[model samples]
Target: MVTVQAKLIFEGSEDKQRVLDLMRRWSSCMRYAYKRLLEGHKRNELKKQLQGIFNLNSRYVDDAIMKAKSILTSCKERGENPKKVVFGGRQLFEKLQKRHINGKAYKKLQLKWQEKRKGNLYSRGDRSKKGNLNTRIEIDEDCTRLRINVGEREYVYARIQPGWKIKDGRYIDRNQLLEAISICGQPYSVQLKLKSGVVYAYFAIEEVFPQPAITRANGVIGIDTNAYPRHVAWVETDEHGQLLGYGRIPMPELESGSFEKKEYYRWQYAHMIVQMAKEKQKAIVIESLSIKDRGRREDFSGRRSRRIRHYFGYRSLLEKVKLLAKREGIEVIEVNPAYTSVIGMLKYAPQFMVSKDVASSYVIARRGLGLRDRIPHNYMMFLGRLDVNELEELKEYVRKVVKNTYVRKKQLREIGRVIKFLQSLESEAERLSVPLDGTSTGSRGKNHNLWQVLKVAVVTPLSPERVLRDLSVLKSLLVSGQVGKTYKGASSCFLGQGLWLSQIPPAGAGKA
Candidate 1:
């Protein structure tokens, strides 16, 4: 469990009064230190000033400084103006600008605002001090209480309400406060938050994940997140790397929404996927995708690429899946997303009559099972037909076609990305044994590196020449009786930039 929330019951009114006073003073100290931090005061400079101004000793003052500096840092990270920021709710504070309330309503709002401004006490935990120093937990078999040391030898006690609560959804975790303190030395932070007038102690503990019961050796579920149609594609596969079943979960919410709304749906979808894995006793496989840096494709300058890159909440969704999977003892495997889309489109989509996204998930699942893909012999033959110098010729021809025959704005933007994608493949081919054609006229080696096969595979599937549409012709032409039967020494064909990108020879090719 990462957190434990148990109500505190004070023994006497005097203890309650003392705790309230400390809370008030602590809030003041933190607010003052926060202002000082805004003025460029260092922690050491503010620490001495805080101790002298407030009744808090050096340790308490230091804690206040830590908390204040964190808030200041948060404001910087989130692009919020620290000067105009309200300690209480910003919305409530802004209400006075337009006279939003009066009389009884105004009094009610004022009370709430004041409560928020001065209703908290926090003490960071220390491992050497056995979990905590200021806010300490004392547990006997019969009784459990919080010992809050105010100063000198004086302290106040708050008896914790004893009972078991559900932890991490299903696990019954008690205030293993005793276990954490005496045995694990797992430091836990405590914050005394006051609501209405009663103080509640909120403890944040390090979550413990269970040992996985279901593993990748049995079976697995592969997941892929998309932005355009807005759905999460999942494919179930057995340990032998064969597809068993698949489904597409609607994610209309990811199209456009608030961060909170998107997060809620991410968790919701993550839970559904994890539950399916548990029911089938299978592991979960996902592409290790990041929002900002999605591996080699980061340099694509297309609008659709940039928008899709930023829009899909891939990282957040993956994190939630991993965390929940760990809690339920479900194993999760992450595979490189580099060419999953192209493989799915070129190989699986035609074979299974599935969407490109679903096909991609299938590839991801197979990859997680330690399966590798070899370039189809015909495709390898077509690659062998093109010499190293022909790389530049083919790229120029495709660029002219794209410029001459464009369609939708979004389509054009995406196709423009293919131009850069080809360039990247070009760069990857250089200065190493980066195999583009490992055929009998082998440029590099007899064996194909996945990335090398990827170089040629990536060029055709994603653009105007849709691989899914031309799969049959592609098979008949490339997979016919001979390796280079149809496309070999092909004459220049009228190839255009838009859809139906018929492969054409570069001008002056016959001379070459």
Candidate 2:
């Protein structure tokens, strides 16, 4: 059977005082029962049974009494009348049954007590002269609205205007009623009512329904998140782990010297990447960064630092991404970012060096770099050994290959251009004493740079002849000093954006 539910709101301080007094009296009754049992009274058998009941009932009485005393004390401390108290009779009864005694006799005893105190129980004092108890209590579907009865030969039941049916069958909390003086605190799932200019609402106590599950697909996408161009890298993979296509989209530039703008763009980029994932029918895999207790330095300092700490809202963005992915039936997975930039570079190194000839070579090379291996360091160390050299000639050659990788080169150019432009704009703005538009300032000029870079990186050599040719190009670029410091800036950008990209897609993909 469906449970019947209703909510009652107190009218004034007198009503509250009455309820508190009742709870205190109830506590006193339990104490008296215990004393009688200890004293070996004539009702010794009854007292013995009541001792068990009193022990169980003491908790409820203590809780109710404490709440009542708290309200009255607060009113007294503030020099206000203690006339209104709100308590759930049904909830109190249920608690008693669950915690104290349950059976026909206990039920009868409860009914008898309520019947005996029908009028004076909640309306005993002068403050209740309006006679609200006789009229105001209300019952409605899912306990959304309340009805009140006020005196003066008039009914004063408070009624909440009906709205949408309560979703997920939850009830409001009693504390919510005591705290909510305005409608803003009302439960979104249920409507509320107010009497004497005070509002009270209730939310369902039941657990919410689980979110719908999403179906799985064979398509997979590797998302490399970055700052200047939020969704910096995207690679589509087929069922057999073949790279079908890959691309990167540059994000709008965030105004320099504006941390808030930077954070806002972070969220925007994350959202756009999630959207892109949905559109492409691909599952997303992202690098996970531990935001809490990760010992990361704050981007801002002083009061600005405090504001960034309090308002950056990365947690909220993560929640949004998860929700969006859930709704769209796309899968999102997180991988450790500890060495992603380095690993990705190594995997795609050959393609960038020879442009078109080494594409297939990198694909085969990357197949062995998966972090899922039981021994990640062993694998990484192996890759490191391939390019490690103390000799200047060999060292330069390896560095060139790593730098020439399609993603690395493109990322380096993007960062250099963006930083240069931002620094230049900052200098100009300082001179002019003007601020640039926060959303309009970044390295979005190279629209096709990401795709071009990937295309250059993915071209594999079909034969050994091509591999040798690509290796020669790698050696030349390294020795000639054509590539500068391995672009660490892009790695930093990816770290920042990775947090935003990790939560995408609605379903879990099969093990990679």
Candidate 3:
């Protein structure tokens, strides 16, 4: 699979004229043959018949005419009738043949149509098109020079000023090309031009193979996508419930506050961390967020939420990790994130009242779920089970309470102000002798209307103190509006229920 790419360099003014002239002559001959065929002459017979008229020394022209004859013969043999035989097909055939013949010396010649036709026959209705193939022309490494054979009588070569150095260990080895095809193998080299005014060639050596599998590595890292400060918490676990290492990479803040930049930086950091983890021989685990949901819009009032969503490239990051891990021979697994955050917080930070605990738990939960079920239980089992339905139910309940509390708080504040205004008005009316009745009207610029105080109390009897304390523990959720006011009334009912069944006890306590 020797591949070659080239860009045109200087073709002397005279050489350009000669090339154009040859092209014109070839085109004219093809047109004449096509016209003869359309005028009721047999195309195959006519193409072969005209071969002798031109000097057969021009292999390019001969090859083109031969191809046209082949196409006409193919169509006739297939028992299909074609409209008109055209010259375009011949012109293309000739150009490709010419390129192949010229590039054959460089071992970069790739001709798909050169082989005998197989399976299908050409039809008259098929459009004629030109072939685009890279014509390999080698330049000497010592000096930028190209080798070309012009006419049957002369061998011409041109040299460019100043040689360019190849990059790394890559070099154009004449011996390699001269060797047998099996020994030469595939061409895995790419040409690169550097800013230092030097051109370099890079080749992939066959020595690099997949790294030895790390069978005993029993740890995994979980990553969470964040907005303001993006970080991936690594909760290292062992065979037993012993914490190993916890690491995080804080994304650098963008000066412009562009979330897209933040996402890019986050991905870069994640990529680096993943590589580092692999070097340390740890498997990576990440969330498999739905692409469609990531882009879905919500009727949110905060501009920050919208900005973060719009700029967040979660799908891209996930895809990048998957691809990079595979190439590096490191396993990357996606686990359900239903309540990883909550579980992570419950298991790791029993005393710490931080929103990150939930996020951290989410990462841990995803990794824990990805582990093989047959693996012996240890810190992973303590991380909790991957019960999708239970996690979703808890998340939904938390979200509903948070939303309801937020709406109620706003309503209460507005209603309180309105009540104060009404009370002041009623007092003034009483002092001015205005009737305190709904139908009362007075002539001394006094009118009265009875107003009923609207009772907007929430029906649930919640313990305000407990709710407040829980709210403090969930500051991140509260600030982000992920959780609503703690329903104090609901807390007691939850205590007797299975609310904390999945919750893990503190690090030192027995598993609950």
- Write candidate 3's Cα lDDT for 295-351 as tens digits: 223346456655655555556666667655666777666766554543443223433
List CA RMSD, all candidates: 8.0, 21.4, 20.8
Whole-model Cα lDDT per candidate?
Answer: 0.69, 0.38, 0.40
Global Cα lDDT for candidate 2? 0.38
Worst 10 residues of 2 by lDDT: 499-508
The TM-score values for the models, in the order shown, are 0.64, 0.35, 0.38
For candidate 2, write residues 1-512 as lDDT tens digits. Answer: 11122344455666544433433344444344334433444443443454355332333333323334454558669986544322334454555566466688677656544432231212111122321222232344444333322223434333443233321122345334322322322221222323233333333222223343322255556655443222356666664556677666564444243655555565566667677767766666554545432112433344644444344444444455555565566666655544344324333443344222123222322232342312122221221122112122222332355554543444445333433333443342242232221122235433322222222322221111123233333322223312212343343211122211122111222224
What's the distance in Å from true for residue 43, model 3? Answer: 24
What's the CA RMSD of model 1 in angstroms?
8.0
Relative to the true structure, candidate 1 reaches a TM of: 0.64
Candidate with the larger lDDT of 1 and 2: 1
Cα lDDT for residue 293, candidate 3? 30
User: Which segments of candidate 1 are over 4 A away from where they belong?
Assistant: 140-143, 162-166, 171-184, 208-221, 225-283, 289-317, 327-343, 352-355, 366-407, 413-512
By TM-score, the candidates rank as 1, 3, 2
